[model samples]
Target chain A: MAESRGMFFKSAVVASYALMLAPVVMVIIISFFRQEIISFPPEGLTMQWYVNAWERREFARGFVTSLQVAAIATAIGVPLGTAAAYALARAKLPGREAISTLLLGPLAVPGVVAGTALYMFYLRAETWLDQDITATLSGLVAAHVLLTIPWTVRLVTASLQGMDRSAEEAAANLGARPPTVFMRVTLPMLRPGVVAAALFSFIQSFENLELTLLLVGPGRTTLPVAMLSYLEFRMDPTLAAVATVQILLVTAMMLITDRFVRLSRVI
Target chain B: MAALVLPAALLVFTLLVAPMALLARISLNHYSPTELMVEAFTAENYIRAVADPYYQQVLATTLGVAFLCTVLTVLLGFPAAYWLARMESNRKSIATILTLLPLLVGNVVRSAGWMALLGNEGGINAALRALHLTSGPLQLLYTPGAVIVGITAVVLPYMVLTLAAVIESIPRQAEEAAANLGATASTVFRRVVLPLSLPGVAAGSVLVFILCMNAYATPLLLGGPQFKMMAPAVYDQFVRGNNWPFGAALAFILLVATLVLTVIGSMALSRRYRG
Candidate 1:
C-alpha cells in the first residue's frame, strides 16, 4: 500500500514539473507553425516566422542595443558589486545587514516604480545640467546597471560565505599585501562565483523590461521591449520564433555557465 | 576595507536614493496637464489616489489576484518541493536545473506561451471543442482567471525553490520519528513536516505575493487593456497621460502596500509558529 502511494506521489510531482514547463514547450512548438493566426493544431510547419522575425529591423536593432547595454552594465556592475559583497562579508562593517539590504533592496522594488522615478529624476537632472539624460543610451544603461547590482551582490556574497578562509589567512601571514593577496589567491578561488555572477547579471540586464520601457528612446529599444511593442501590433508566431531563439540563447549560456559553476547553487 | 564598498555605495545612493527622493518629492506636487507638473505642497495626489473609485477597484483587483496566486502556488508547490527536498544528489541537480530554467527566460516570452495556450483559438479551447466538452470556444483569455494563472506560473518556481531549501534542512528522522510513533504517513506529514516548514511558507508567500502585486507583463498580456492593475496603472500615468506627479504618487502607494502586506504576512506566520 505504501509503495503504491509513493509511486502516486512521484507521478504527481512529475506532472507538476510538466505543467511548469508547458508554456516554454508550447512557445517552441508554436514557432514552427505555418499558420499566422495560430489555431489549435498547426496544420503545417514552416521556418517562415524565423525568417520574418529576422527580417524585422526593430528586432535586429533592439538585439544590438540590448547586447551593448547588458555587456556594459555587467562589466561595471560585477566588479563594484563584487567589492561590495566582499566588504559586507569580510569587512565586518557597522550595520552590515542594513547596508546589505539597502544595496539589494532594488530587487524587491517594482521595476515600473523604479523606472518612473528614474525617468522623472533624469528629466530634472537634464534641466539642471542643460543636457539630455532621458531616452538616451547612457541613461538606459545607468538604469540597467541598477538591475545588475543586486544579483552580483547576492551570488558573490553566497560564494564568499561558503569559501575557506585558510588560504587568505596564510597569504596574510606571508607578508603579502591585501591587494596582492586578493589578486593572486582569493580572486582565483572566487573565479567560479564571479563568472556566475557576471553571466546572470548580463542575462538580467538583457531581459529586463519594466525598468527599460520608459528609458528607451525612439531608436534605442532593447529586445524584450521591442518584442513587447511588436506584440502591440501583431500577435503571431513571429514572437514565438523570437522567443524560441531567446530560449535557445539562454539555454546555451546556461550550459556554458554550468560548466564553470554549478548554476543551480547560486541561482 | 570600507573603501571596497564605496563604488557600489556611490552607485546605488546616487542613482536609487537620489532618484527615489526626487520621486517622493514629486508625488507631493500637483500634476498640470499643460505644464507637466507645478511645484506645490499639497496632499492632492495621495488624496486623489485614495478617493478615486477606479483606483480603489484597481487596488482591490491587485490584492485579489495576488492573494489567489499566493494560495495556489503554495498548495501546488509544496508537493513538488517536498519531492525535490527528498531526492538524491544525482537526480536532484538535474531536477533543480529544470526548475530554475523558466526563471532565466524572460516573463514576456513565457506570457506569449500563455497567450497562445489560452487564446480563443488556442490549444486549450481547441482541445475542449475536439473533446465535445464545449460547443464553442470559452472566454479563457482576457479574464481574472488568466491573470491569476500567469502570475502563479511566474512565482511558482520561487516558492518551490524556497520551500525545498527549507525542507531539505528538516532531518529525515523527524518524519521517521513521527511514523515510528504510530502516526500514519499523512499524519506524519501533517503534524511533523507541515509545522516545520512554516518559515519557508511565510517567506515564499511574501515573495510570491510581492511579485504578483507588481506583475506588469503577465497581466498586460493576459488581462487585456480594460483590466487594470497597480503596475500597469502606474505606467499608464507616465506614458499615456504624461502625468509624472500622479504616477509618482501611485508608484509610492504600490511600494508601501507591497511592503506592508509582506510584513504583516510574516508576522502572522511567525506568531502562529511561536504558538
Candidate 2:
C-alpha cells in the first residue's frame, strides 16, 4: 500500500509537470509551423517563422535594448543592493526595520502605480530641467533599475542573514582590515546571493512591461513592449516564434546558472 | 555605513515616496491634456471616483478577479508545493526550476501566450472541440475566466516558490514518527503536515493575493478594454482621460488596499507560525 501510494504521488507529479509544460510545448510546436495564424494542428513544419523572427530588425533592436537596459540596471542595482544589505545586516542603524520595510515596499506597490508615479515624476523633471527625459532611453533604464533594486536588496539581505557571523570574526582575528576581510571573506561567502540577485535583476528588468510601458520611448522599446505592440496589431506565429526563442534562452541560462549555484539557497 | 544608508534612503524617498507625494498633491489639483498644468485644487475627482457607479463596478470587478485568482493559485499551488516538499532532494530541485519557468517569461509574454491560447481559434478552443468537450468554441477569450487563468499562471510560480521554501523547512521525522505510531497517512498529513505547513500556506496565499490584486498586464491583454481592473482603470484615467488627480486618487486607494492586505497577510502568517 505504501509503495503504491508513493508511485501514485510520483505519477501525480509527472502529470502536474505535463500540465505545466503543455502550453510551452504547444507554443514551440506552433512556432515551427509555416502557417501565419497559430491554429491547433500545423499544415507543415518550417523554419520560416524563426527566419522571419531573426530578420525582423525591430525584434533585434528590442532584444539589444532589453539587454542593455537589464545590464545597466543590474550594474547599478547590485552594488547598492549589496551595500544596503550589508548595512542592514551588520550595522547599528536607526529605523532599521522601517528602512528595510521601505526598501521592500516597492514590491507591494503595483507596477502600474510605480510606472505611473515614475512617469509623473519624470515628466515633472523634464519640465524642471527643460529636457526631454520622458521619451529618453535613460528614463526607461532608470525606472527598471528602481523597480528591480528592492529584489536584489531583499535577496542579498536574506543570504547575508543566513551566513555565519563567526567567519567574519575569525577574519578580523587574523588581523585582516575590515575592507580586506569584506573583500576576501564576506564577498566570497555572499557570492551565491549576489549572483542570484544579479540574475533576478536581469530577469526582472528584461521581463518588465508595466513599468517599461509607461517609460518606453517611441524608438526605444524593449522586447516585451515591442511584443505587446505586435500583439495589439497582429497575432501570429512570429510572436510565438519570438517567445519560443526567449523561453529557450532563459531556460538554458537558468539551467546553466543552477549548475553552478543553486537558486533555492539564495531566493 | 551612514553614507550607504543615507543615499539608499534618499533614493527610495525621491523615487518611491516623492512621486506618491507629488501624486497626492496633484490629486488635489485639476488638469487636462489640453492644459499642461492646472493650478487649482479640487475634490471633484475624488468625489467623481466615489460617486460614479462605473468606477465602483470597476473596483468590484478588479477585486473580484484578483480574489478568484488568489484562491485558484492557492488551491493549485498548495498541493504541488506539498508534493515538492515531500519529494527527494533531486526531484525537489527539478520541480523548483520547473515552477520558476513561468516567472522567466514574465507578465507580458506570459499574457501574450495566454492571448494566443485563449483566442477564438486558439489551442484551448481547438482542444475542447477536438475532445468533444464542447459543441463549439465557447466564448472563453476576453472573459474574466481567461483573465483569471492568465493571472493565476503568472502568479502561480510565486505561490509555489514561497510555499515550497517554507514547507521544505519542515522536518520529515515528524511525519514519519506520526506514521510509525500507527496513524494513517491521511491522518498524519492532516494532523502533522498540514498544521506545520500553515505558515507557508498563509505566506503563499498572501503573496498571491497581493500580486493578483495589483496585476495589470494580464487583465489588460486577456480581458481587453471590456474588462477593467484597478491598475488598468488607473491607466485609462491618466493616459486616456488625462485626469491625473482622479488617477492619483485611484492609485492611492490601490496602495492603501495593498498595504492593508500585506499587513493582514503578515499577521495571519505570523500567527500561523506561532500556532
Candidate 3:
C-alpha cells in the first residue's frame, strides 16, 4: 500500500506539471495552425498567423515601445538600485530595516493602485511644469523604473550579502581612494549581481501591464497592452502568434543568460 | 553609504511615496464634472464605498476569489514542490527551468491562452463532446470558476518556487529517520516533513494570496464584465467613469486589504513556527 501510494504521489505531480504548462504549450501549437478560429484539433499547420502578426503596424510600434521602455528602465534602475543595495547590506545605519522596507514596499502595492497613484501625481506635475507627461514615453519609462527597482534592490542586496568584502578592504589598505576602490575593485566583484539585476528588471518592466495600463495613452501602448486591446476586440490566432514569439524570445533569453548566471539564484 | 543610497531613495520617494500620498489626498477631495477634481476635502468617497452594497459585493467577491485561488494554488503547488525538492541536482535544475517557463510569458498572453481552452467550443469542450461527455458546450469562460483557474495557473509557480526553496533546505536524514522507525510513507510526510515545511507553506501562501488579491489581467479577461473585482472596479471608476476620488478610495481599500491580510498571515505563521 505504501509503495502504491508513492507511485500515486509521483504520478500526481507529473500530471500537475503537465497541467501547469499546458496552456502555453497548446497556444504555441495552435499558433502554427491554419484555422481562423482558436479551437483545438487545429485545422492544419501553417505559418501564416506568425507572418500576419508581424505585419500589424500597431504590434510593431508597441514592440518598439516596450523595448525602449524596458531598456531605459533597466539602465536607470540597475545602478541606483545596486548602489542602494550595497549601502543597505554594508552600511551600519539607523533605521536600516525601515529604509529597506520602504524601498521594497511598491512590490506589495497592487499594480492598479501604483498606476492610479502615479497617474494622479503626473496630472498635478503636468500643470506645474506646464507640460503633459501622461501618455509620454518618459512617463512610461519612469513608471517602469518604479516597477523594476525593487527587484534590483532585493536581488542585488542578496548577492552583496554573499559577496566577500576582504578584497575591497585590501584595496582600501593599499591607499586607493574610496572612488577608486569602488570603481576598480568593488564594481568588478559586483558585476554578476549587477548584470543579473539588470536582466531581471528588464524582464519585469517588459511584462508589466497593470502599472502601465493607466499611464499608456493613445498611440503609445506597449506590446502587452496591444495584445490586451486586440484580445478585447477580437479573439484570433494572431494573439497565439504573438504569444509564440514572446515564448521564443524569453526562452532564448533564459538559455543565453543561464550560461553566465544561475537564474534561480537571483529569483 | 548615505550618499550612495540617496539617488534611489529620492526616486522612490518622489515616484512611489509622493504618488501614494497624493492618492490618499485625492480620495478625500471632491470630484467635479467640469474641474475634474476640486480641492475640497471630504470623506464622501470612502463613505460611498462603504455604504454601497454594490461596492461591498464586489469587495467580497474579490476577496472570496482571491482566498479561493490562494488555497487552491498552495494545495496544487505542494506536491509539485515536493517533487522538485526531492529530485537530483541535474534533474532538478532542468525541471525548475521548465516549471518557471510560464512565468516568463506575460499574464495577458497566458489569460488569452486560457480563454481559448476554457471557452465554449474551445479545446476542452471539443474534447468533452468527442467523448460524449456533454451534448452541448458547458459554460466555462467568464465565470468565477474561470477566474479562479486563470489566477491559480498564474500564481502556482510562485507558490511552488517559494515552497521548494524552503523544502530543499530541509535535510533528508529526518525523513529517512522517520521511515527507519517503521513509519509509513504517509506518516513520514505528515509528521516529519509537514512540520518542518510549515514555514514554506506559510511563505508561499502569503505570496500567492497577495498576488491573487492584486490580480488584474486574469479577472479582467477571464471573469468578464459581470464579475467585478476591486482592481477592475477601480480601473472602471478612474478611467471609464472619470471618478478619480472614488477610484483612489477603492485603490486604497485594495491596498489596505492586502497589507492587513499579509501582516496577519505572517504573524500567525510565525507564531505557529514558534509554538
Candidate 4:
C-alpha cells in the first residue's frame, strides 16, 4: 500500500510538471506553423514565422533595446547589490535590519505601484535636472536597475550569511588589504552567488513589462512591452514565435546556470 | 560605498515611499483631471471606495480571486514539494530544475501561452469538442477561471520552492523512527512530517496571497476589462479615468491591506514554527 501510494504521488508530480511546462512547449510548436492566425494545431509546419519575426526591424530594435537595458542594469545592479550585501552582512553597522529592509522593501511594492512612482520621480527629475531623461534609455536603465538591485542584495546577503567568516579573517591577518582580501579570498567563495545574482538581475530586467511600459519611448520598447502592444491590436503566430524564442533563450540560460552553479545557495 | 548605498536608498525612498505619500495626500484633495486647482481636503474618495456598492463588489472579487488562487497553488504545490523532498538525489535534482523552470519565463509569456490554449479555437476547446465533452468552444478565456489558472501557475513554483526548503530541513531520522515503530507511511507523514512542514506551508501561502493581491498582468490579460481588480482599478483611475486622487487612494488601500496580511501571515508562521 505504501509503495503504491508513493507511486501515485510520483505520477501526480510528473503530471503537474507536464502541465506547467506544456504551455511553453506548445508555443514552440506553434511558432513553426505557417498559419498567420494561431490555432490549436498547425496546418503545416514551417520556419516562416521565425524568419518573419527575425526579419521585422521592430523586433530586432526591441531585442537590441532590451539587451542594452538589461546589460546596463545588470552592470550597475550587480556591483551595487554585492556591495550592499557585503556591508549588511559583514559590517555590523548601526540599524542594519532597518537598512536591509529599506533596501529590500521594493519586493513588497507591486510592479504597478513601482512603475507609477518611478514615472512620477522621473518627471520630477527631468524638471530638476533640466533634461529630457524621462523618455530616454538611461531612464529605463535606471528604473530596471532599481527593480533588479533589491533581489540581488537579498540573494547575495543570504549567501554571505551562510558562509564562514574565518577565511576572510585569515586573509586579513596575512597582511592583505580589504580590496585584496575581497578580490582573492572572499570573491572566489562568493562567485556562485554573484553569478546567480547577475543572471537574476539580467532576467528581471529582460522580462520587465510594467515599469518598461511606463518608461519606454517610441524606439525604446522591450520585447515584452512590444509583445503586449502587438497583442493589443493583433493576434498572430508572430507572438508565438517571439515567445518561443524567449523561452529557448531563458531555458538555455537556466541550463547553463544550473550546470555551473547551485541556485539554492543564492536564492 | 556609503555613497552607493545612499543613492539607491534615497531613490527607493523618494520613488517608492514618497509617491505613496503623494497618493495619500491626493486622495484627500478634491481635484479633477481637467482642473488643476484643488478646492479642499475631503474624505469623499475614501468614502466612495468604502461605501459604494460597485467598489465593494470589485474589492470582494479581488479578494475572492486572490484567495482561490492561493488555495489552489498550495494544494497543487504540496504534493510536488513533498515528492521532491523525499525523492532520490538524481530525481530530486531534475525535479528541482523542472520546478524552477517556470520562473525563467516571464508572466507575460506564460499569460500569452494561456491565451492561445484557452482561446476559442485553442487546443483545450478543440480536444473537448472532439471528445464530445462540449458542443462549442467554452467561454474559457477572459473569465475569472482563467485568471485563477494563470495566477496559480505563476505562483505555484514559489510555493513548491519554499515548502521544499522547509521540508528538506526536517531530519529524516524522525520519519524513520515513525516508520520503525510500525506506523504506516501515511500515518508517519500525517503524524510527523505534516506538523513539521506547517511553517513552510504557511510561508508559501502568505507569499502567494500577497503576490495575488498585487498581481496585474494575469488579470489584465485573462480577466479582461470587465473583471476588475484593485491594482487595475488603480491604474484606470490614474491613466484612463484621469482621477489621480481616487487612484492614489486605491493604491494606498491596496498596499496597506497587502502589508497587513503579510505581517499577520509571518506572525502566524513564526508562532507555528516555535510551537
**TM-scores, each model vs. reference:** 0.96, 0.93, 0.96, 0.93
Candidate 3 C-alpha lDDT tens digits along A1-267: 978987877776876676578788877877887888876677788999888998997788888999999999999989889888988887786788887887797787778888899999999999999997988999999999887779889988887788888999999999999889989998888777787778778878888889899788888989999998887765678888988887887777666656556765656
User: Model 1 over residues A1-267: C-alpha lDDT tens digits?
Assistant: 778877777876775676678888889999999999989788899999999998988888888898899999999999999999999988869888888887897797778778888888888899999998877789988888888888889988988989999999999999999999899988898888899889888888988999888888888889999988877655689899999988888887777788888755666
lDDT of candidate 2 at residue A104, scale 0 to 100 = 80
The residue-by-residue lDDT of candidate 2 on A1-267, one tens digit each, is: 878876765665554455455556666777887879777767898888888887887788888898899999888877887888888888898889999888887776678788888889988999899998776778877777776668878888888888898989999999999899889999899888888888878888888887777777777889988887787666688887888877887787678768756766555
Report the CAPRI category for model 3. medium
How many angstroms is residue B230 displaced in model 3 relative to the true structure, after the best TM-score fit? 0.8
lDDT of candidate 1? 0.87
Computed on C-alpha atoms, the DockQ of candidate 4 is: 0.52
Best by lDDT, which number? 1
The residue pairs found clashing in candidate 2 are none
Write down the C-alpha DockQ for each prediction: 0.66, 0.51, 0.67, 0.52
TM-score of 4: 0.93
- Please provide, for model 2 over B87-163, each residue's C-alpha lDDT reduced to its tens digit, 9 standing for 90 to 100: 77777677778887878777766766776677878888888989998987788778888888878777877877887
**Candidate 2: where are CA atoms >4 Å away?**
A1-20, B32-37, B133-135, B261-275
Per residue, candidate 1 scores C-alpha lDDT tens digits across B150-239 of 888888899999999999999999999889989988788789999999999998999999999999998888898788999999999989
lDDT of 4 at B85: 75
Sorted into a CAPRI-style docking class, model 4 comes out as medium
